[model samples]
Target: MEDGKLTVRAVERALDIMLCFTGATELTLTEIASRVDLHKSTVHRLLASLEGKGFIMRDAATDKYRLGYRLWELSANLSKEGDPGIILLPEMERLRDQLGETISLYVQDGLLRVRIQAVQSNQAIRRVAPVGARMPLYVGASSKVLVAFAEPALHEKLLASADWPTGLDQQAFLQQLSDTKLAGFATSVEEREPGAAAVSAPVLDRGGRLVAALAVSGPANRLTLEVMQEQAPLIMEAARRMGTMLR
Candidate 1:
């Protein structure tokens, strides 16, 4: 192979090693080398270079390498294609102003739900879950709403097989999913994190399939059953409008 071809092959292998950190928390150099089909010494050299650049780091006690905080920092700044999130920020702002509650847009990635956009509430007490935050499918209102309305195969698989961080029982989770669909939205009081209550409704695409979730969150005391019920229509309307633009 030419010099350029060898360089490209080496770069591809390095990237493969880096991609392994997406779902996994950490891996030893030997483990990474074996997965990538590279020599351990070569993997170590590449990892050292990536670590020096703040893309990877090793645990002091375990000596296992994982993605660095810098990787998280960088991923948060990435924009979606055509940047609908940026364009929709004003709409989120309008909803926040109207309701005085924090609003967010979440999308599914495999078994995880990622917050892609958010608008902070103007109330004295505000929920502070940041954009780029992610949680398992069975945790938050937004996550469950998405899962409930997703394809039945995916819903069953996630409810049956995927390990939820929240440790919720499968049967109970399925029940909640059923209720969320009937209500046309989801509401949870501290299901995923403490001291917060969230309401979420599905965001459909042009095809009217559930593609994302639109949510509002606040203190449990402030966001009572009546309040979330009132906000449901507003959230559903906003999701419908946004879906038109996304399509």
Candidate 2:
């Protein structure tokens, strides 16, 4: 039992060292030691083990360590493994067929949202949101849906931050979020992109936790306020279907 505990502590320390690389490209031994609160020799030992496993690499000239390609490979593989795109593709296709608008699935990543799947509209002038596109968590219908359904702690943090979308203050945004929650969905008109409008619904898991957002977007001219209001039910139904399948 003691040996197992020691192994677990070692793994945790190693992970702490790796997590120090967040928002940083490279770190020297002293920087890592300071961040992880470990002795230089202990940090060196951990670095050696990580280097051997290709989780980090040491530059020959600078002696600084950076994340290795193996981490990227593992992250990519993990993203692929847990990707909701494959599971949601059929629903997305069905919604696309029904609405004839661009369909996208967005998942939260920290304070940002990423588009994991997108099906472009068949029309010539339709909006296009490509897979892998990232946007702040405070703008657009999809982002608002995520924020509306997110934890209260996250809401407080985001509200306190200086990242509110243009022409919106904290009070107005909070009211908007409240309205979104009450309505069970969100809508935006030229919020993120000019002449683009979208409606989004939250996809929740079995435990009633927000998982992702399903959005349908198109040009504002075609997807006017009335049109979006009319299609709200369809968008929400599709979101419910996706949530059911995911659960």
Candidate 3:
């Protein structure tokens, strides 16, 4: 037990040192030690250990340390492993450019839909949602499509449970889900934001599993009901293309 505790502590310290390299292009031994709250010698030993394993590298010219290519390669592979964001960004950009509206990609993380990618429209008037922001599945168009196409059991669980109360009754929201399914996509005018309207479509993987959602949003006045109906097919097509790429 004591040995396990000691090993855990060592691992924690090592992780702290590794995390300190982020947001820094390069860091010297003293900088790393100060940020990681370890003595210089201890930090150096840990750095040497990590470098030996190809997780970090030291620059001969500046004597600074940076994350190694091995780390970069691993991160790249892991980011694309089950994530649809990487494969969808190119299409998202294309859609944004075509419609002159903001485009976003999101995936369900527990009860929240987390945005993983966004492209700002070039127009002077635009809608913007930052990457990594979380929104409830019950309110936004991007979130609702995922919930609409979700498995029946999971959909019932989400609807029956009293978790997210975005100032709407669950029964009414369930009716909205039915509507979304009928339309083959989800759309909202000022549901998430006061003056923004959006249309969203689901991205299904090769296994026909719901992987993510792609949404295009803009000013409500411009995105009328007729306009949304017209644009819905385009958004769905873009998502379908992304799904093919992911497969």
Q: Which ranges in model 1 have alpha carbons more than 4 Å from their true place?
A: 1-48, 51-82, 162-167
Ranking by lDDT: 2, 3, 1
- The C-alpha TM-scores of every prediction are 0.70, 0.68, 0.68
Model 2 misses residue 6 by how many Å? 28
lDDT of 3 by residue, 1-247 (tens): 9999988988898888887764477999999998988899998988998989898899999999998888777866674665567767888899988888899988887777888889998888888677777777778887789888887776777766578665688778888888887887998999878999999999888788888888989999998878989999998898888888886
lDDT of 1: 0.84
Please tell me which model should have the higher TM-score, number 1 or number 3.
1
What TM-score should be assigned to candidate 1? 0.70
- Specify the highest-lDDT model's number: 2
Question: Per-residue CA lDDT of candidate 1, range 45-156, in tens?
Answer: 8998889988899998999999887877886888766565676688788889988999998888888888888998877789975777778786889988889888888786
Would you list the C-alpha lDDT of every candidate in the order shown?
0.84, 0.89, 0.84
For model 3, the superposed segments whose C-alpha errors exceed 4 Å read 1-78
Residue pairs with clashing backbones, model 2: none
Ranking by TM-score, best first? Answer: 1, 2, 3
- lDDT per residue (tens digit) for residues 81-151 in model 2: 44578888999999999999999999999888988899999888989777877788888999889999898
